[model samples]
Target: MKPSDPEFQEFAEAANLPLLRTARLLTGDWHLGQDLLQVTLTKVYLRWSQADRWDSPTGYARTVMVNTYCTWHRRRWRHELPRERLPDRAGERDTADTVATTDALARALADLPRRQRAAVVLRYYDDLSVEQAARALQCPPGTVMSLTFRALARLRQSADLHDTAVEGR
Candidate 1:
């Protein structure tokens, strides 16, 4: 219930990377991912009392992110065009191939529909179970499976992603 609790700060630090990565995948841009994570964290902070009682606050935060993204989808004005250049990375990569692969994947993911993107990220990236993903998406388990199937199929078929190595889970 404490807004400035040390426990909550520790939890936030531990969850930041995974949450940010999931947000990045969901939004198809690092900047949008930062915003998504900030919004989700703000919501969690506002409900600190309830969140502190949870056994899995990271999962709850992720659910909030998915829900927020879905809410954003319904708002026409929230959609924006992609930027031509990516933001600078904090560290230099040792290899060019790694950069190319990730760039291709990001572009491919950006082309996917929102639900498809969410489904893929939740089910694969987050390694959530079908039921878990379904709950996060507020849909039936069957629907989650369907979305995952369609999303993977689309990703597999994408010409931009054709040359990139994909590992199916």
Candidate 2:
């Protein structure tokens, strides 16, 4: 059960893809997902044995990513806002469009309160049961359900705006 055990590494490897996807959903940016995954994996590596003993390694990693993000947000002044402008990319229309959509999604996600964003990612992206997400988030199941509902409502509103912009283009 020790993180150093060979079995632990195997589990970590198996969990990597889902962890990456969850990270992407949580951060709404591929680059941020990479950074989040790296941080999460490093934490997992440090405590592999203990984490391996958990019923769900994926859940543990998700929790770690969420916590790390929340901690980062707290350390930075809450008033700090993300840049509203997209980066310049010359001669790659496809790449530019993708980046724009990604940035839009990231902005939407970033606008959400941390707990609500975590709830959406855990329930929708990870497809964890309400009970499981509650356990991971250390909140009551009812609270998880409430957060999930609010998160989805907000995301739907953002999606509507995105659709309108695309249709007008």
Q: Write the per-residue lDDT of candidate 2 for residues 79-154, one digit (tens) a residue.
A: 5457789678666445665656666766787779888998887887778899988887888999999998998789
Which candidate ranks first by lDDT, i.e. highest?
1
Q: Rate the local accuracy (lDDT) of all candidates.
A: 0.82, 0.77
- Write down the TM-score for model 1: 0.77
lDDT of 1 at 122: 94
Estimated TM-score per prediction? 0.77, 0.71
Where does candidate 2 stray beyond 4 Å?
A: 1-5, 74-104, 159-169
Model 2 lowest lDDT segment of ten: 72-81
Per-residue lDDT tens digits for candidate 1, residues 56-102, read 78878888899988677532224666779977874565656677788
The collision pairs in model 2 are 2-49, 3-48, 3-49
Instruction: Give the C-alpha miss distance for residue 12 in model 2, angstroms.
Output: 2.4
